[model samples]
Target chain A: MIESVHEVLTRSALVSVAATLVAAVIGIGLGTALALARIPGKQLMTAVVNTGMAVPTVVIGLAVALLLWRSGPLGHLDLMYTVHGMVLAQVLIATPLITGITLAAMRLLPSALPDQLRALGANRAQLVLRMWIEARIPLLAAAMAGFGKAISEVGAVTIVGGNIHGHTQVMTTAIVERVGRGDFNSALLYGAVLLALAFAVNGLLASVRHRGASWERN
Target chain B: MGAELSLRQVRQVRAGREVLRIDALDIGPGEHMSVLGPNGAGKTTLLRLLVGVDRPTSGTVTLDGVSTARRGVEVRRRVAYATQQPGLLSTSVRRNVELPLRWRKVPRRERARLVAEALDRLRVAHLADRPAQTLSGGEQQRVNLARALAIDPEVLLLDEPAAGLDAQTRSAFFADLEQALADRATTVVQVSHRAEEALRFADRVVVLVEGSVHQVGAPEALHHRPADASVAALVGYDNLVSATVRTDGEVLVGGAPTGLLHRGPAGAATVAVFAGGVLLADAHGPGLPVRVARVIPGPGHHVLALEGAVSLLAHLPMRVQAPLTGDVVRVVFDPVLSVVLPDSPADPTPGVLDGVELAYPSRVPS
Candidate 1:
């Protein structure tokens, strides 16, 4: 039983990590772009992002399930019931969270900063670079939230990945499976392992953020 | 290498209202010109136009005959603006000053050299290694100015850099600023409502009123001969009274001959007597009769608010025996020092004040 728990735990950890890693890259980039663009309907876009942040994991799961269901539009990719399908769902769920937080943080910056930069001969690209450096701490928080959201979410991954044992099951889905099988002991063990994994990732992020280091300062 | 900045027929309309209108104004190469005005006078708007950070609603802001709009990138490289608030990054002062040079893509060797020179010129070299966020208001402003100078800009635009500093710090800061500016042939255009500092620093001054030029002259000339009563009050003329011009070129205040002369046509005019322009004398002959309403002591002079048919403010040198409040004495007006500003028929007299019951409310004390 303990050996089976170990295999399940490892499998779950791999899925969660894969989902989080892909989500971070896409979310941060899309979020930063959304915050910087000055197009019309910005308020409407912001409202949509806010609503997306509140979207249920189950809704995302069902949507991805339909899209990759062999008869669906993206069925040719054969990603349904696969770890990649689970990652795509997680990315969708986390991108708006990042965009909303990043937009708020960027707006909090002093209004005089951009004007002063232009007067000093900085162009658009340079202004964006400077803004990133200046708002790095908040941007890091956005990344942290995205990772947390992707890892802790269950319904979406469970639906898209089908919770197949030793194949596509992540930590969240594994715990749900253990409980379903009436295996109380295994469920508790999986839950503990999930907590430790989350702690490690966030701890690493916190250390980097607080240290800020000479490189970021420069 | 200084740039000649000019504004021609510049009219700025904000929110469907004309906020600024300049027919023609020019700043010579390497000249220090200060735009002096009260609040809402569009002084900042003018500075922003010169730096190419903002475009005028209509008309051209040109540098060396090239319109700022046509050569924005090139013009921005030549001008550096130091705003009122110090927009410093939370980094070392050295890094803060180096950012502009970096933005301009100056070579690493030259960047370091220029940054160090600017920091030293602003007298902030000792704080170079310190984080810019930890500096005081004055120190931060110094660093802010150093960043502007790092590019070796030909034109420097300052928006009240010394505004938040204490008197001693402000004077000291400008002394350092002057010394630093003397090092380079930079044309400085500063916007200041503080007359004393503007007078001390600028070679030429443009007095703006409600987004229009009221007067443009040297500090001394503007102080001595304001364009009108409004301009006179701005330059610190404490006692403004209504007077009429005489055919003999004399001014009459309350039907009393002032012995002052103006080339104005014989009609109604406004008289501006600065507190320092009038005095109380113990001469053998009688002067104007006045009762002292208040006497405020100063470092070298005592400012007396005298009460008569009309209230007069006089600043006289400290006497061995100073006159007490409510004491009646004779006051003398220095015709050479006072100014006679012609009043248009449409403009109301600033002299006809309301409710000046501070001296004599209803009846004079016997």
Candidate 2:
């Protein structure tokens, strides 16, 4: 039991780390694009992003698993039941969270910033970059929250990656597996680690928000 | 770095509603022009169109003989427009000032020197390193001005730059602006609601009403000889009376001849009497009888509200004695002081005036 617990801990840590990096890259990129796009159906796109934020992890896992299955159209890449598959599922769930939160943050910036930039002769690209940098801290907090959410989710990884030993197992899945196998101590240890990670992410976000508010007052 | 600006019949329509309609305007190089108007008179919109921040629905805004609509970027580089509310990037003041130079691809050494000079000119050098979000309103406005000046554009467009500033700060800002203009061949087109500021600094004043230019002339002409009733009201003519042309061509006020008459043909018109133009004297003086209603002290004069069948106000100097309420008095005004406007058919209310037409051209013949 002790050996199995150690193996699961190591595998879960690796999967969490890999999934977090992938999710951050895709989520933050798409999130920013969605925030700045001036498409005709922008409000509808925003609504879809907001709805994605509330979707259960199991739903994302099932949808992504079905799409990557051997009989599915995208099965040519053969990503099912692997670490890449799990990362894909996590990014799918996390991207909307990042995009929605980023949109909200950009909305909070003063309305005059864009006009002012244009009046200063800033090209469209410069305006976008400057506005993004101005909104960086809040966007970072949002991306971090998405990272934590993806790292802590169990159902998505369990279904899409099959929670394979030494391959796709992640923190939440590993904790559930440990509990099922009567290794209560291992489950408790993993739970404690997850709680600590969540606390750290939330603490960082709180500090950023407080700092931003102070900057506004001055 | 002065550029000539000419707007020929520029009209801007948004969502089927006309936002700005300027028939014609010509601002020469090194000229300082002020636009005075009430709220929603399209002052900001006109400024935006002139700077290429907005495109007109029809007509043209040309800078130095180049059409801004066709040459957007080139025109923008030549004009610096500052909005009424200061807009700053969510970055350091230095970075905000460095933006225009960065856009022009200016070298780092030159950019730094220009930014420093602009900040120093606006007296906000101490705030160069601080984030713009940390600055006060006045400081932010100064920083905005610094950023606009950093590029040293030929034309400067200011929209209500001194609206929220204190009197002392406003005066200082105007003085700094004057010095800056003197140092460079910069042409300025500013929009302001403050009459005193416009009178003090503007070489010419243009009055806009309801999205159209009502009058344009030298500052003193607009102040003393407003083109119409709207211009008169905007220039601080607070005492307006609706009078009928009696048979003898004299204007009768409350059933008595006041010796004020229109220079044009006799007809219904609204006569505008500036508060300063109405003189108050003791009851024995040779003028129309009036009853003193109230005396209100102003910045440099005492405003006396006189009552009869019609109430009038006289703004006398501070040394003038205040008359008690209900005390009989006499009021007189120079016949030239009153501006009579032809009555409009839309407004038939006996004592309420709508539009007033001018009899003489207000501009001095060149």
Q: What does the lDDT read for residue B320 in candidate 2?
A: 65
- The list of candidate 2 runs beyond 4 A from truth reads A1-37, A197-218, B65-74, B246-249, B281-288, B335-337, B344-366
Instruction: Give a tens-digit lDDT track for model 2, residues B1-366.
Output: 689999998999988999889889999998889998889999998888888877899999999999877777767877898888887876689988998889879899999999999999999999988989778888888888888888998999999987799988888888887776678889999997767776677889999988999889998788656777788788887777766665455665666555455445456666677776666543553456788888888988888888885788877777666678778876654444556655643221112111112111131121
- What do the candidate models score in CA lDDT, each in turn? 0.80, 0.77
User: What DockQ does predicted model 1 obtain?
Assistant: 0.58
| lDDT tens digits by residue: candidate 1, B202-289 | 8888988899998888888777777777667776778888878777766667775544565666788888887865555443333456
Q: Locate the minimum summed-lDDT window of 10 residues in model 2 chain A.
A: A8-17
* Candidate 2 docking class: acceptable
Error of 1 at A13 (Å): 5.9
Clashing pairs in 2: A218-B134
Off by over 4 Å in 1: A1-37, A69-73, A213-218, B254-259, B281-290, B308-312, B330-332, B345-366
